[model samples]
Target: MAYPRKPLFAPNGAVATSQPLAAAAGLAVLRRGGNAVDAALATAVALTVLQPPSNDIGGDLFAIVWDGERLHGLTAAGRSPAALTREMVLAATGRRAAEPVAALGGAQARGPAMPARGWLPVTVPGAPAGWHDLHDRFGSLPFADLFTDAIGYAEHGHPVSTGTAIGWARAVAGHAGLVGAEFAEFERVFTVGGRAPRPGERWRNPDAARTLRRIAETGADDFYRGRIAEALDAHAARTGGLISGDDLARHTSTWVDPVSARYRGHEVWELPPPGQGIAALLALNILDGWDPAGADPVERLHRQVEAVKLGFADAHAHVADPERAPVPTAALLDPAYAAARRALLTERAGDPVAGDPERGGTVYLCTADAGGMMVSLIQSTYLAFGSHVVLPGHGFALQNRGTGFRLDPDHPNVVGPAKRPFHTIIPGFLTRDGAPVGPFGVMGGHMQPQGHVQLLAGMLDAGLDPQAALDAPRWYWHAGRTLLVEPELAARPGLVAGLRARGHEVAVAAEPSVFGYGQALWRGAAGWVGGSESRIDGAAVGY
Candidate 1:
């Protein structure tokens, strides 16, 4: 069944998001003589307020941009505190920790976790610094202007979209103990009776508004080196947390050339190694070698699945911070190596097995303004509510992304001082003949690469529109050996068996699968075609 919503096409500028208000906010910025970078920054700031459960100012941000002539990537992902070490955490808890989510689950099972107290889970928040850096480098409008829409939404209130409401409700229920006085205060301002506010229900966040106003009045320094930093450090000090004023002062976003590879004449660009954007690139590279033009539908699906499995094997084995990771980038993406890896996919699927390679939220936006500038940006708190740490005066939560690091010293992504962990959040862009073609992203921890593969196959190989490609059925193989196929795709019974025959140990998803919340802006002959996933309650707007 097709979703009933009119598609938006604009010749000059457009924005697509999981919420219509956000799209409108970006479009408004574009109309106000802002470039794509400005529009995206506005929309991103707005999302932090409107989609609080999935994102916050205390999270991490990653982006890819088309700045006229070349593509650029911003890796503003947060890092573990310099004081944080595996030994320290193990010593504090008197046990070796699993993933952060695992620790959260354990805490839930027994009682409230330390993170609920708003101190222990704090990390060096990168979003604020990242936003400032982007504006300083490429934005056309005043940095203060970007916070206006976000501040208004937080203070005066905005309708809660269906997708956001559902996600919020789930987060609240899952991490009930994390709900402290600060969260309770937010409930009083935003929710009705400690429950999710329905779609069209008005919700406000006065605390967040106050926080934004502070940043606007004092500038980014207030966040990194001034009062805000002091407040964050104080909270961590009182709790068992590790962040320091030095960490805040030292935090800065990195600007680097976008990493990319050619796939079927289209160039796919993503952030480099420290992030897992290469997983998507590697998958596309493997698929590019396949004959999508002549292969049967089932055969195409089989090859795509095989390619992803192989790509992920490499990702798990080697991808990490380039400074620390042992595997060379050239070796991993080498054509000869890819051919050798592709050989592992037999005509028949392998046995039902978990891919033991690497370990693993979120808003995605794509904006293009009248200046011909484009940006694909993503930000998140890792899991919903992050470490569930809501700083008191900062009006933001912090990310638990440090949980992705391993305690095993031998692991490529093992936690260390000044090292970026293997990140799941990645933004993507596509170009053809050296010109930007589209800005898109698939957001879900491990499912990101899989989502990218499907999106590329649909748009480039099958010639489907952006929305149709996103609307198409999707699947994901969890690290736990479960093959969570979406209900729509499950309807095709033999397909599962076909994959099973090839040796995949598959099972139907207990809920909707972790495919991705995709958003994109495709450059077509007509103009810009903006598309947002129907699975998410969002829209694409253009002018």
Candidate 2:
């Protein structure tokens, strides 16, 4: 189904998000004389309450901000518990940390990485700090003022939108049988009457309201060093969790430099390491080598898919916590190296190996204020309902970001104490000629970078508008030689067959959610132009 173009244009401010209410929350902040950072912070906080299945107060955050003069990057991701170690995890799970499993013929390799859910994978959350720090740096409104809408929604309840309802049901189904104590709090807080809420159903979480209020009033200190930390400590003690008060106190959101790749005269910017954003940059680097302007439709997609494969292969091999491991970000994005990597691409789908130069959730929301400040932000709990270990009486779950750590001792991403993991959620921005274009991002685990490439290609390469860029069908590169495309993209004339002829495996996606939900804001002559996801219950509001 082709979505019709109905872009929102506003003279003063614009906000876009995966949930409509969240978008409205940001817009309201802007109307209240807040800057772009404040509006984005409001939207992000509102998403925690409105889209619990995707994000929460327990999640991590990353953002790229254009604060009139230049761009700024924020990495609010948390680290592994200070007490956690590979040996401890192995012992807890009945595996030998120093020995290899019998199935693999290695003498000294560990077993698989940590499980997807439970206390072992829970990391100290950085979102509260993220909110406070972003505001401290670039925000105009009072920090407490930003929480008004989120607290109201949590206390008084709001109708569940279709997208949130669908994700909520799926998360409930996924965790149906794990009746352990670690998951009990999640079940209690999220499920009402032993089931997920239906669309348009009013759902309330007064506990979350109380928590947000405290965080706001206390400037988020309680979450890291005070009452909320005490509660988290007690809960961890009762549930055999590893996070402690010290771990919570040690967590901080960092202000880092943003990285960029030049694509067709425009520079696409993303947050630096500890994120897979570099993958999007690498893929764009490869795509830049080709004149996609006059390329065949099928051929254009083929190159795009192949480029992403190469990008992911290298990113998986080398993109880790740079503070813990060496990541060759500069060498990888070098034009000469990108050209060398591009040399591997052919008419057929080929599995490209990682080059030596190497390396490089998850709400995505963007806001633009009349002051010319633009912000691109993304926050997530890693997976749905995160570790399934909700803070008792808090009505929020902890993120399972520890699962991103590889178990192998020789790997760059090996699990260890006080180290950040390879993160999936990233925020993106675009600019040309040293001036800001606007903020943009796509929210879905691995589909994020892929969506970035496709979005930019549609706009910069194909001359499509923001709405058309988002409304276009998407394709996800699943694995080696395999591609999962939307039904609409598959239905394109000769597209699937053409891809198959090039030694690619093409399957129409079983669900549309895998393609991701995206948001974008572009500066127009009259004001800011915004586009939101058509596949999800999202909106791009302007005022």
> What clash count goes with each model?
7, 0
**Over 4 Å off, model 2:** 1-3, 100-111, 352-361
Q: After superposition, how far is residue 240 of candidate 1 from its true place, in Å?
A: 1.6
- Model 2 per-residue lDDT tens digits across residues 1-543: 543868888999999999989999999999989999999999999999999988999999999989899999999999999999989888978888776632111122234767778988888898999999999999898999999999999999999999889888988997887767778877778988879999999999999999999999999999999999999998889878999999999998889999999999999999888898999999999999888767788999999999987787767677788888998999989999899989989999985542211001458899999999999999999888888889989989999988877777777777899999888888999999889999999888778888999999999988887888999999987556778899888888999999999999889985878888899999999999999999888899988
- Candidate 1 wrong stretches, greater than 4 Å: 1-6, 96-121, 177-193, 323-327, 351-360
User: lDDT tens digits, residues 1-543, model 1?
Assistant: 555444568998999887778888898999899999889988988999888877888888999988888888898976667887766655555564544322111112111122223433445777887888888889888889988889999889888888888878877676655544334434453347877778779987788898887776665778889888898788777655688888888887888778777799989998887777777777787777777677766677778777776666666556666766665677767778777766666786632222332212688899997667899999987777677666764567777777556555555766667667667788899999898898998887778888888998888888888888888888786543346677777678578777667666676663442667889898767679888878887778888
Clash pairs, candidate 1, are: 18-538, 348-502, 349-502, 349-503, 350-502, 350-503, 352-505
lDDT of 2 at 374: 96
Best by TM-score: 2
Give residue 506's lDDT in candidate 1 (0 to 100).
Answer: 70
Model 2 TM-score on a 0 to 1 scale = 0.96
Residue 69 of model 1 has an lDDT of 84
